[model samples]
Target chain A: MSAALHRIDTLAPRAEASGTHIAIAGLTKTYKTRGGSVPSLKPIDLNISKGEFVAIVGPSGCGKSTLLKLVAGLLPATTGTITIGGVKVTQPPDGVGMVFQSPVLLPWRTVRDNVLLQVEMRGRPVAAYREAAARLLHTAGLDGFEERFPWELSGGMQQRAAICRALVHDPEVLLMDEPFGALDAMTREKMNAELQRIWYETRKTVLLITHSIPEAVFLADRVVVMSSRPGSIEAVYDIDLPRPRDLSVMGEGRFVRYTQEIRKHFFAQGDLDH
Target chain B: MTDTLLVQSTRANVLSKLMSMDAIRPLILVAVILVGWDLAVRLLRIPPYLIPAPTLVIEQVIAQWPMLLRETMPTLTATLGGFALSALVGIPLAMLIASSKTVESYLYPLLVFSQSVPKIAVAPLFVVWFGFGVLPKIISAFLLGVFPVVVSTVLAFKSVDKEMIDLARSMRAGGLRTFIRIRLPHALPGIFSGLKVAITLAVVGAVVGEFVGSNSGIGYVLQVANGNFDLPLMFAALFVLSMMGVILFMALDAIEHFLIPWHASRRPDPNSGT
Candidate 1:
């Protein structure tokens, strides 16, 4: 426990030295409905540095996803600015990829075509990205099944293709919204390790919103715990786990300490399962 | 070695099941119905003018094949022409309705209102305006067939997973790109469903037009046969019409299967052990 505390203490200085890649200042979101305006997120400040893996974990309806969407520029911030790589994001920022909870693949497209969807969407010549797509699919362990359709693949494989699609364009940042939430526990654990390896290799700055405490600890360098409804940052715990994390790391002392520390925040609020 | 054997046996099991009696059940039921009808008509000694036996209908079809074939051309032409027109017009209209709230609010109700008015009732009006020609038949078919395409397409576009749209936006996909790559492909199964219904309706619409005013088509032939007391010929024409509907429907089904084999509906049943 003391060692875990010491690791958390060291994260701050290292993060400052690396320099910020994504800066969120006074960001908030209020959804205007017919009845009245409902505040989803309170004004919040957070900085994620280049190649940093940050996971935002909170109770359901805490607006953790709202924060991610604001950064992705899918939704406008009610008040404040989000600058990524020194530019303000008014519309969706370029060079950003996202994976949703469901695979959401095009049923008519094969696995290879689905991965190249990013290139096609950008109006870039898909022919040029063929090699890159193949490599990414290979990395995802989906090389032999490029011609297969989404329904032919299992849920885990489909999600892997979604990840490959996101990365095919070599995005600067990858935002995920509870990507493995639908998977069984064993598959989710496997995906966490696969994601960590991918992150290590690609080194894209990532912000993942998740409900699972262990998942956040397993994959993220820092876990940002948020308060329930009208969410605001409660605490940010630096995982401080070693690089290239595997499932075995979950059994380590620091890993359990990190997960427990984050879980305690939700346990206090009486809504932790979600 | 055991794993490969297990997989091979599973494949064989699925193949055998597919080729089993279940595959031919529909054919057997059809044969039974026809045989029953023939036997009942012969035993009761029903007058051919009132209700021709299946054998007499087949004899009439064989004897008048040339005339029947000639009349079938116009009906086929009108059905195909109007269905094509509906697809061309309805798809864009649906896209317009789905993309803009103003268009949807104004036009959607108007479309629903138009759909409520019995299309058969409107067939006479089309003949009065366009005259007793193929144009009126085509117009009537277009009117009847277009509603399903528009409604189903609108629903399809609306029902696209919101998360998938967010993924596209986060990747900096423009509105056009999003529609082409994400919205269009994602809405295919729904669109094809609409197309199937519309194609069948197109056949009905053509027949309705002929019933109101036409000298060609199977409907006109049926009217002529009835006036001359040639009940078997009338039944043969009716048979041709039903066959046309089935052929067009099966064609659409084949296209849907080929295009979206990845869809849940097209996937092999899991319990079949494939």
Candidate 2:
């Protein structure tokens, strides 16, 4: 087999092939405004298997983030349905964790308390999850800063706290919309490594939406490419790169080739799309 | 070296405390204004009744301290009572309006309409309904103050990022849980700003209520001073009333500081974190 498979049908066999975790069938979105209804997403179909990491890459205004919101059940689809963990998702489903581009942590809360917010919001006993919150913060390299406020930490640290908040409830599905998009280049690369380590330990099903081609190639088991404006899936590439990936892996030939392959789509469309 | 360090640090501390922009700038401006007013009144030979010198006002405060103290108590009670009432009721009302379309549609317009009707006009109505007791003054204060708290709180609750609410929903947090954990805390800074405005307005409301009808309070003292044509006493009452307004505003500011030190407005202290 070639290093990356572009065909949707010719994909390799996997543990989750028999059972799709997050199934999106003909999902679409149209926003209503005073002017008229504007199409945001064309009918899109994709399947993310349990414990698999998938990253959707597209140019700005492509609605890749919309797709993630749809799967997370934060938004109602214009057409079709989404299923997560064998249940139809009408409202925001349980056992799902989401992180946005901004940290979105409460300013009044300490880092530890912000993480425990997930547990507290779920009506769970906060005392029980204290250790879990502490461990998650520790893993995120924020052990000593648990009592600190979100503003006291750097941008990367705040996002780390937000990630920990997402996982504190022990949600099986982790949906991220450009989680490290706000960080500087160096910090983003480090966060990518940190995310990989966290994912390695937890093995949660993750659907990350991003514009960076290399970020998509580096983190995902499969990279789904999206079109601009009324976005639809353009191509899917299976990443055959070795896991337990690090910052150094980004420099490898395989990783560079995958990113270049994805970048080719935007270049073909227009330079302005990137 | 130690002695020099101590001296340098002490000088720095004094300079910062005396010259800092936070509180000292405003204090300096007030001092300038008072001195300029004193000079202008003496130079121009402005009559005491038109604008008494600051010195005469200070002397009036000292001479009639007992009477002023007696009147101040009632106004303070009414202001605090009305402010507390508005906060207790207004926050929940804001949450209701934010969460429900039905409440927003019916109640929001009515609230806006209520604001359009002047509080001075409503003060007489409150006095007529409740008689000349402190209840009328409190109701007047509540009428003037509640709108800001509700409006600010509503805007604050609505301004919370849609993603934050989604994150809560995905965690299986119900409506109340989403509000308590996410919405309420996020809305605090806005609510506090509204409270600060409301507190000052509450003082004005109490005075207005007394102007319309009242036996006690600083407003009554002003009315008596007006009848007597004792300009210094009038200036003293005005001075005391303004001081009370500042004190109430500062009280809310202090509360805001204690509650949300993590907020950007409260984090200007450079030596806060290590």
What clash pairs does model 1 have? none
TM-score (second chain) of model 1: 0.89
Q: Give DockQ per model, in order.
A: 0.67, 0.70
lDDT of 2 by residue, A71-190 (tens): 888789999889998899998888888899899888888899889988887778889999899889999999789999888999999999999999988889999999988899899988
Question: In candidate 1, what are the lDDT values of residues A1-274, reduced to their tens digit?
Answer: 4655533432242477788999988888999999999999988888899999999999989999888888888898899899999999999888888888899888788999999988888778999999999999999999799999887899999999999998998899998989999999999999998999999999999999999999999998888889987999888787777788889999998888888777878789998775
C-alpha DockQ for predicted model 1: 0.67
The TM-score values for the models, in the order shown, are: 0.91, 0.89
| lDDT value, residue B72 of candidate 1 | 94
> Which candidate ranks first by TM-score, i.e. highest?
1
Looking at candidate 1 chain B, the ten consecutive residues that score lowest on lDDT are B15-24
Stretch of 10 with least lDDT, candidate 2 chain B: B265-274
Q: For model 2, what is the alpha-carbon lDDT of residue A51? A: 92
